[model samples]
Target: MSASHYHICSRNIGKPVEIRTRDGRVHRGIIHRVDNRMVYLRPLPQRNYGGYGYGWGWWCGFGWGVALGAIVGLALLPWFFW
Candidate 1:
């Protein structure tokens, strides 16, 4: 499929899609909820990551908190330290 054809929009809700988190884990599920900047998902049983917490399993993926924080820090270094 073409990249333009895959663009996500309002119609994506209720459709099945796969999500690849920061750590490379994949979650396939229906698009249960969507807002301007976020998606709330309810994964299918077969695609589950096997241990649930924060609505995700151990194999689901890692959070973006650390990565994004480090990126922000690096971006500020040139301005504040240099």
Candidate 2:
């Protein structure tokens, strides 16, 4: 696992982030938690309606677990982009 990715993820808890993994897939979600081997993400609700923001979308109770070792790139999303 990349040490920088771990530190960045840990420091940015509760913030929205987009992560690109080594396998070429991208994951977008809020940083829920971080650990030695993985980072848990609270998935952003998919917007099915006409507006934007957190309030309008389907919400899942569980968060996603991504291995820090698989991450190739990660960035914090600005409020206007969410």
Candidate 3:
């Protein structure tokens, strides 16, 4: 499971993705980086916090890490929005 998560996260580096974890939490962000056990996601704005383009580039700091094993689903989005 983690192997596939690693594969998917690695493949989508720098691309936008929506990840669902076993904990029932959903994360929408750019695939920042991946490691042996974690996928870092640079989260987009939720509503009015930062909006689109807030941390949309490489200049943005590294995102929080989510354990690969905790991830149950992953998908790439066509575009980013609030």
Better of 1 and 2 by TM-score: 2
lDDT of each: 0.39, 0.86, 0.83
lDDT of 3 by residue, 17-77 (tens): 8899999999888888899989998876444446566353444485788899999999888
Q: What digit string (tens of lDDT, one per residue) describes model 1 on residues 1-82? A: 1122223523575555555545655544555565444454555434346675455233254222112111111110121221
Provide TM-scores for the models: 0.40, 0.80, 0.76
Candidate 2: RMSD to truth: 3.2
Q: Output the worst ten-in-a-row residue range by lDDT, candidate 3.
A: 51-60
lDDT of 2 at 46: 64
Worst 10 residues of 1 by lDDT: 68-77
**Could you tell me the lDDT of residue 49 within candidate 3?**
48
Candidate 1, TM-score vs. the true structure?
A: 0.40
Per-candidate alpha-carbon RMSD to the true structure: 15.4, 3.2, 4.1
Question: Against the true structure, whose lDDT is highest?
Answer: 2
Cα miss at 69, model 1 (Å)?
13
